[model samples]
Target: MQNKLRIIGGAWRSRNITFSDAPGLRPTPARVRETLFNWLHYDIAGKTCLDLYAGSGALGFEAASRGAKSVVLVESNAQVCLSLKNNVAMLSAQQISIAQTEVSRFLAATAQGFDVVFIDPPFTKDLVPTTCLTLENNGWLNPHAKIYIETERSLTLSGLPANWQVLKHKTAGEVAYQLFERG
Candidate 1:
């Protein structure tokens, strides 16, 4: 199966990008994206971004379209990676790069720091907090970097870094979304 996710704002506003129907590949809803970008209003332009679990590439593409200097999308599934590539080509986005690897592996190998990091792992796995720790310990985020996390509403965030502060948080249906700043 195939589906489309629209870029809600920025240069690519109103554009629709296709994605594969891979399992656990839920794209962030338009309302959520709008809210997230609003929270990140002035910080996105010319900043480097990391989408830990690219999935439908909605968030990464939106960042690129919004004037991010560069956006790295990391996805473990091959099918989803291909879909991401297709979207990149379709959008002619020069600021986006795709990494066909797991979040842990990519973080372990890369020492680059990003100004913004999006962490939306599959709901079945408890990877958000662990990934957050890895990003902190591995130096993958610049000081005061913004990290966006999405998970089940019932999950506890006890595993996240001590210095991280929730700048914004909201709930939609069964999902909980938050934007944190590393202090």
Candidate 2:
């Protein structure tokens, strides 16, 4: 269980969100989140982002804090969604929005494409690859959008969209980070 959550950078530099690891939750570590955004958003200002499976909304709020023009965080679980809403309100991030729906539903509903899409589904279920496929199938992504994928290091991905290719891949502890773009 993580006791402290942090904003990666920007106006809320040292801000912390107290996170308790409830069932099916593992918030990304501060260092990893910071590094992930740094690589993905060379200059995130004015960019739009969608954070799928936004556990705790850590990554989504991080983008908004860093000056993303619009950031949406989607979560289905009622309890988690409530907490996510509270966190978003607490941060008072005008650019941020929260949707109470699973990733698939949100993807199916939103026609708004994003410059960056951060996918950090539950690691235990190993849903990262399926989520990636669904996103492409549901047309949630722009042709040139960048993806930040996090998954357990042991999972192997297959059947990726032909045009989607990895730009950078790395592992920190159990979290594997893959930065992907169109081929």
Q: Each candidate's TM vs. the true structure?
A: 0.98, 0.91
* Model 2 C-alpha lDDT per residue in residues 1-183, reported as the tens digit of each score: 445677869878788865545677788887788788778667467888988888778888888888899998888877777777767777787888888887877766747768889888886776776787877877778778888888888878777777898888888898788889855
lDDT of 1 by residue, 9-58 (tens): 89999999999998888888889899999999998999999998999998
Off by over 4 Å in 1: none
Q: Rate the local accuracy (lDDT) of all candidates.
A: 0.92, 0.79
The candidate scoring highest on TM-score is 1
lDDT value for model 2: 0.79
- Name the runs in model 2 displaced over 4 angstroms: none
Instruction: Write down the TM-score for model 2.
Output: 0.91
Total backbone collisions, model 2: 0
